[model samples]
Target: YNKYFSLGISVADEMFGLLFFVLMAHTAYGDVSYSFLEEMKRGSVIGNIAKDLVLDVNRLSSRKARIDTEGNRKRYCDINLNTGELTVAERIDREEICEKKSSCVINQELVLENPLGLHRVIFNIEDINDNSPQFKQSVIKFEIRESALKGSRYLLDEAHDADISMNAVQSYMLQENEHFLLRVLTRTNGRTYGELVLNKELDREQQKEVTLILTAVDGGTPPRSGTVAIHVTVLDANDNAPLILPSCLIPGCVHIGYNITITATDEGSPPLSSTKNIHLTVADVNDNPPVFQEQSYRAHVQENNKPGSSICSVSATDPDWRQNGTVV
Candidate 1:
């Protein structure tokens, strides 16, 4: 009875083993597997890193799974968040691969914007405090009429501080000098001026050009400074007097028909001050009475001489010549 019971148990065990074998073979036909374990391992690595960094694993998985499940019509790749690296999972067409080999992958290293590529991806690098403010031009120029009134604002060329806002411009400063003084001139047009004031009225005769040193300081703590030389020129003004020549002395009236010369000069600016030869004309006055060599000359007395006959010879001398001389 014991032997028969043992034989029945062995047969039952053999039947159960055959049924298990058939079930496994039927399931194998539907499982089209190609290293799913390796893919799962790769997926877990990315998923774990994303979890640690609090990134979206679902989004990354969706992007990767799209190509994994469907053979890369859209050409997808997997990124390992843990390593900050990319792995190409499926390639849509042969053109997607550089070498056309099974392992050739698309590179997605973060790079600057490129104009030539057809498709691109960008990752922005957050800025860190890096650069100091700098001026575009070290020197700038402006022209102002030297005749410009005192306290009149003459703005210098505005400087550009290239540093980011709040770091770019500090208050503008003028160097200590006798001739130049600087001030800030703000306007409604969004333009600010580094106004330069002339300490004294410019005199062209004294100095044609005036130079001043100007500086720009950024508002940054321990401010940065830039300096430029400013040149201002004084223009000429026609404000001078005409010069007069000294009077000439001549002997008075002894010689008849004597000529004397007089001149005038100017002390004014050029083109106005140059001397021109001008003759001085003097009119004779009756103050100088003409004198005769002798008061009268003896002549033959004839009782019957014509009433108008010359009785005596007379002569006189005049001190002046031409229109100035007179005979009476």
Candidate 2:
């Protein structure tokens, strides 16, 4: 029986095009594991295997099964010359290599010269508790309305860890706050996030501001953790009724001259309402009366003056303006 695995790569470029394919497989097992995060030297033994039924361990076939890394990834391991055991070729940083991926494997091609056969081996890099969780920012700020009801959930930024599996971020903890609690939401992709839930109503006049501490811990011996500072500000709510300003000042009587604009304001978050246009009307008060410029007027005209002859005109002034200032 023959067992075979194939890898196909298609590349397209404006000036060039290339298609690549390679095949690799193990004689018995398909995958293997190695402890990562440790300082691996250039020739540290990782595993042992036989080549062409030569398991004597004296005359090994390491040269026949030379190690070859794929693409641009630096070679991390190679087989020993006399022992025929896989050895570390270069230092491997699991965090930098895998990042957010769950399945982290190293691909290598082992080519034998005598029979001219190529075999691929997948080395699964097992994670260790080497990295701590980290948040994108040092401080997070949340602005909420004072009228927000209880049981409201606010989404929060998630913490990230370079490690994977049990070594990755496991849980989140929020510092005890009287009006707020913390919740962790797990997604379909096995990702977790932090959420701040309101336990009671917020009052801007009573407590305008609050601070919380969020911590993320990983599942490891002597677990490592990270923290983020959370600051929440309660916004004002519309609670006061509209207030009309005390009347406008008048010099003489501006009612007939110009229109007065009175303002109505409130003590809410938006202090002013849309109804800022006020129609100020001057009420009619029967008080001051218009008086003529002179108490008496004497007009001297020639005898037998023309029917439509000109005569002296009288003018009057009133202290009150607008409707009260009207004089005939």
Give TM per candidate: 0.39, 0.58
lDDT of 2: 0.72
**CA shift of 186, model 1, Å:** 4.0
Tens-place lDDT digits, model 1, residues 25-85: 4323332111111122223322232333333544543333111222222423455533433
lDDT of 1 at 153: 67
lDDT score, candidate 2, position 76: 79
Would you list the C-alpha lDDT of every candidate in the order shown? 0.47, 0.72
TM-score of 1: 0.39
Give the residue spans of candidate 1 off by over 4 A.
1-138, 142-145, 187-192, 242-328
Q: Write the per-residue lDDT of candidate 2 for residues 164-218, one digit (tens) a residue.
A: 7777888999999888999998898887898999998998889999999999999
Residue 242's lDDT in candidate 2: 66
